[model samples]
Target: MRQSKRIAIIAHNNKKRDILEWAEFNRLFLAQHELYATGTTGKLLEQELGRPIHKLQSGPLGGDQQIGAKISTQEIDVLIFFWDPLEQQPHDPDVKALLRIAVVWNIPIACNRSSADFLISSNLMHNEYQPHLPDYHDYLERNFQEHAIQVNRELPFPVGTV
Candidate 1:
């Protein structure tokens, strides 16, 4: 990760005020990084912080998936998502997938105000840190080999003889 981290901020409907307040309190620290947010959250944060934010579609409309894609590609370094646990979201699967992708990519994530505070205040946030990336080559090779064997077994002749 670079010293200037790429941070993605998101908030569910009920938790928007909390995230906005937290963000406003930490505006100076947040301003040092590249910020991204979903539609309404982006607009709100931009107005509060008076800074430009990279805005994506609303969460229900695929913003979570967009952030997940960025995480997979190593374009985002941190995730601060203030999701309401009590309220069930219509796009819950996307939210879960986004969280899973963040973990899979070994990036830092904060789900609430307390966690976000700790994340931003950490010394790692101000410096470059190399996160370990798990190798999936073996996994991919195994799946491909299995598929080839299955294909050969189902065919009238061996796969290469065709």
Candidate 2:
């Protein structure tokens, strides 16, 4: 049996067409996987592709954070985000956070059509591949251990907050 992946799809307002077109072109390939997307994008994609897509809130309305949380919990396997760099967005921070979480989780992410093509076409997609994920528990434990010596010491504002 082929390994079916959980793919998260997102697109900025201006890039929706491009993402839709890309998804249409990759219909068969995408049909083999589980699909998820933000509200508006998911609706559009469902309308265009005629496929079932799990829909979350709109990006600016907490969808990005939802996806980020999914990444942190290892629920998502791939991300296809066609963001528009030419335009500024009100939810830019959320977008960046989502991308950062994907990176930290060590999942495959595609920010454009070329990369998406490569990711989907890769032979690894059909197989069970283990990614080198950061040991977050170990990292937190190390931090706490390093700070154990300063337990009695009062600090100023937290580091990097100033």
Model 2 lDDT vs. the true structure? 0.91
lDDT of each: 0.95, 0.91
Candidate 2 Cα misplacement greater than 4 A, ranges? 146-151, 155-162
Question: Candidate 2: TM-score?
Answer: 0.89
Q: What tens-digit string does per-residue lDDT give for candidate 2 at 8-77?
A: 9999999999999999999999899999999899999999989889999999999999999988988899
- Each candidate's number of clashing pairs is 0, 0
Output the number of the lDDT-best candidate.
1
In model 1, residue pairs whose N, Cα or C atoms come closer than 3 Å (at least 3 residues apart or on different chains), thus clashing, are: none
> Tens digit of lDDT per residue, candidate 1, span 13-97?
9999999999999988998999999999999999999989999999999999999999999899999999999999999999999
